[model samples]
Target: MTIRDRTAIVGVGTSRFSKAPTDTPMRLAAQAFKSALADGGVGRDEVDGLVINIGWPLGVDYDRFAEALGLRIRFADQSWTHGRFVGPTLQHAAMAVATGLARCVACVCGVSFIQERGLLGGPGDFEGTREEGGTHEENPVYGLTAPAAGAALSAQRYFALYGATSAELGAVPIAFRKHAALNPAAIMRSPLTLEDHQASRFVVEPLHLFDCCLVSDGAAVVLVTSAERARDGARTPVFIAGMQGMRAGPDEFLFATPGLGIGQQREFRYTPTEEQLSVYRMAGVTQKDVDALYTYDAFSPLVWFVLERFGFCGLGEAAAWTQKGRIELHGELPMNTSGGLLSEAHVSGWNSIAEIVRQLRGECGERQVRGARVMQWATAWGDSTIFHS
Candidate 1:
């Protein structure tokens, strides 16, 4: 279905992003959902559809949540395919509202410390799974079973190909930390220096501890409604201008796993592909038209890789581009104005999306982009969405 301007994100809200959140997942989600409703000037009875995303060890039924909220919805779903379901969930809610299957839909997602710590036991505990083989089955031999191992390998290969230095890679975290300093909601608000990023211990060689995202506990909820309904809402509605989702391709896997040094090895990216060009075409916007950018940054290199895939710069040039300060606020294009996943909270990309809404609505005080008209959000896993006020 054509998702261009059919629905609007009328309200956005987020719970505290922290390492030690005391509320249960359900309670946290409810708090954010209610805040979204209030922001939209919507009532609980007005909601006709519900969507929820939860991580491992904290699975909550959508139906039960609807019942608890006293919402009799026409449709409800739990989106938990992988950890990267935020983009897809938003797309699903937009389609529902556009097609009249639901008048108003709430997309809620959150994770708790219990899940991150693996306090509640599952099939195999978090640490025990490391000994087992990973998806490739040959991962254990290379000691590449853990995610950081793959990231480290990718960074090494990327640096070798582009002659990018670790200090150049440090620029990513530095810019994010600068933006985070302006955001009161960000967990890592302390001033950060490139020297500090380089001095931090390496989780995997070339990937420092500062390069990784935090294990945050929080919930974020967004309310989507038809354009007509949103026009009358309390807050200025941010339209869902366009969306595109894609996955890894043969070239991507080859680059990630260059056996015998033979594959499409030139390019290095967090995901195998970027399907954002089509989204921009559908929305009738261009890279230059975007007033602000939010790229998913679970790791620092992700910003560089995705910038290359999205045609923001040539492959291997992202390091130099970042060093030039194009990503900081008041630059050519401000990025992660809310600190992103690296310094901000990592509720997947939910908080990033919220920042976009706030920016478009002129709600962001110190970090606000003046007269921001269009904002684009890209996930590390080949999902992209654009929003405009």
Candidate 2:
């Protein structure tokens, strides 16, 4: 009954990431789709299923994409428009392929943040932030607002509780920027220093401008199919070894670890139990087995929280754990080696998924993790999928 290793991500593709809008979502998606088909040695006619994470006008819609790509899709789905839905969208594709509802499923995301700034969370938008409305994270009537405010609140509390500092937080983006330097497609590849991070202006006091992810335009495609059929693919197959769904409730926050006191999250000493972190149990692996890690790094603080949430390190230890090149390539736990959302363009975290596929295939030359047999895609929001080559 277990779905573990039942499906494999056979191919992945992505468009050039840019800070400025060059092509429409459909145009970029078309390019990435063709690339993915070629990479997987798959034909357009073979794709009978489709799943989308971010939809129009922020990205391409499912119905329009099928018609434009000329795909006769038998199964199709689209998650709500948000960065957090990337993991769920991928898991759905794997489930569809494993249960025989479809032979192959193409998981798609083509977003243009540069084009749709006012649609979602941003500075001074028209649809005044409110509880469970206007992006669901904002409640401006009570001075609780989207994104930056929530992250900053958690970071402040974490710092107060654990003695962490913004300078220590610099290590995350700095590590990712180092990785971005090796990637030709990364938007911000320049050398980043702790001093640079410390000096950067604060977007939401206690959270520097560098702490946020880039607002960019791009598309990425990942093809999912059963493991039996994946063995016949052109490139190596990266098996989806395990999965855990997103968590929610009074104790959970979309941007903070459980019990961080953000939004309605309750405050408590949150040291995750083995039962709380089922991804490791489902994957048949431990944190020690992970050669690399990837996450939706929308904010640098989220990186710290994800590490603690996943039991990679004890609560309040990520700030210290991430130091001294521990997360860089060839380090103890290389992460986001393709630069991630901090330095790499944010295609709603799909860019990092494509990076994971490339890493497992040994295709990434300079930034490749050595002996990367196991890697994971997880997020601070608490969804995860473990993949192995």
Candidate 3:
């Protein structure tokens, strides 16, 4: 039986985001998990499975975390994706429930990098290391160190073809920060101007400091149960309608190949736009049905790339759409309603997932959108992509 319609998210919770935390990662995760359980009207004893997106500088292990929580888990495993683990984790939890392996599954993500180091230096330092034995080190060494650098390459190519400028890229972070200003949990909620984005120092050429996301410490958790049981619990259930993941090839192969960039790429190119379309197809939905969007914004350029990839607009037209305030809270599509990674504290994009849940539940106090039925969340890791609805 298809798991697409079998599971629903009944509980979602998150700790306040911050660049530096006075609390530990485990404590943050525990708080979020407890909040989720309370939101779902379930007890910790009812959680049959525990899933964590593990990998951080805090030296916290999954086994240790489970032990600390005192959960007698039947299924316990950690996700390996750097920042793109949220969607797949939810999908895996949904599958577990659909297949009778679990009744209630809890997925948690925690980050304390900012508490360890400031914005310029933290968690991302060990991004591409090999644990046992591996040899895929070329692309990462050549300045594709983090998601921001890799996305900058795509941004440069996008500008070349679409005639978009760095200023257009500036608008994404600016818009997100504006929304974040209303979120008390956000770290950089102050008003930001295009001049601020253009004036920020460059982390990578064409990708300014403001264009990149903040390194933060926080935790978020979600509870998934069978769709049949979701409405029996707290709040309205948001069904897990669809999900998909795709990988093209090594980063160099997709980036260096001729006719692979934005407008220059061949029809149905191996770009973000095509990847998003493939996800929409898998979800059995259309762009018109997507009332809200939470595209990964580790970097500002990713916003445009994902918009084009999901067929929201033609290649290179994302900048125009964004500039026209079409993505603002009152625009054609309200995006990043919870401030997003750019302005809100970045908990490795886990906060983005929580924001999507809030939008679906109509719980967003200031940045809430009306009639938000369908929402899309996308994340790109290395050269792989994952999407959820």
Candidate 4:
């Protein structure tokens, strides 16, 4: 019944990242799907399971992807369009293979953030309304709205409580921009300096434009199959060593860790205990064993929240922790070595998952985490999966 190391990610593929709507989501997804099949040396007929987190407007649904990609999937699942679903959806793919629901599962996400598609704004906009938003985030009741409000709310609170300034927050994107400069597929590769971050106009008060993720078009796919099948395949396998489900409730904030007091979340001193972050226990390792860390960096504050949520550092210590070269390549704990959602194209965080698989396989050319054996995909909202080479 153990899921650990039973299902391995053997193939990873991604389409070009762009801010322009040069192609459709289905077309982009098809490109990535074929690349993944070829990367794993597996045939299109071998994929029988499909799971997608982003649907419609921002990306394609499971049925559209399966039908358009000519995949005959016996198992399929799709969820609301949000970055929070990335970790859960990937876990579902591994569970499918482990439970024999499908032999090989393709975790797919094709995203186009271009407004020209007419998928965003005007009643078609999916951003939470005052009904759902008032409870979870700060959103306007009129005009076009986005998820940035929630991130901005979280960042403002972190700055006030910990005395961390926006200048300190700039470090997260500054570091990722450095990584993006090395990645050919990244859309925001221009060198970003702290001065540039400070000078950028505010998207929402404390959150400058650079603090938020890019609105880009791209697709990424990761192929999951049993460890036994991977052993017989053409590429090296990156085992899913451990997993912890996404957390929710009155105390959990989508953009902040527990007890940070955003929305309905209660205000208190939050600490990440061993029993709370069981991914490490399930993987039979500790925080010190992780060679690299990757997260859903839709905003700079999320990087700080994820560090505290995962116990990489104490609560409120992330502002100081992320400074220096700590989170950069070859640092104490390299994070988002592929620029993540902040600098890399925002493909609903699937790009970072693809990066994790590449790091474990030693496939990343310049942005690789040297000798990386164990890499983790975690989020500020509290979902995680640990992988090992």
Winner by lDDT? 2
lDDT of 2 by residue, 62-157 (tens): 999999999999999998778899999999999999888999999998889889876655555545444364454555665645567677878888
Question: lDDT per residue, candidate 4, 1-389, as tens digits?
Answer: 46889999989889888898879888899899889989999999999999998887778898878777788999998887776799999999999899999999999988888743344334445454535653235455743255677778888898899999999989899999999888888999999999999999998789999998888899999999999999888889999999999988999888898998887889999988776799988888889999999999988999999999999999889999999988988789989989988998889899999999888988889888888999899998788999998
Off by over 4 Å in 3: 56-60, 115-147, 250-283, 380-389
Judging by TM-score against the true structure, name the best candidate. 2
Give the alpha-carbon lDDT of every model.
0.76, 0.89, 0.70, 0.87
On a 0 to 100 scale, what is the lDDT of residue 246 in model 1? 46
Off by over 4 Å in 4: 116-127, 134-136, 142-144
Best-first order by lDDT: 2, 4, 1, 3
For each candidate, give its TM-score against the true structure.
0.89, 0.97, 0.87, 0.96
RMSD of 4: 1.8
- Report the lDDT tens digits of candidate 3 across residue range 197-288: 88889987888999888877888888888888887987878777777753343232222222334223453344444543565655577878
Output the TM-score of candidate 3: 0.87
The C-alpha RMSD of each candidate to the native structure, in angstroms, is 3.7, 1.5, 4.0, 1.8
Candidates ranked by TM-score? 2, 4, 1, 3
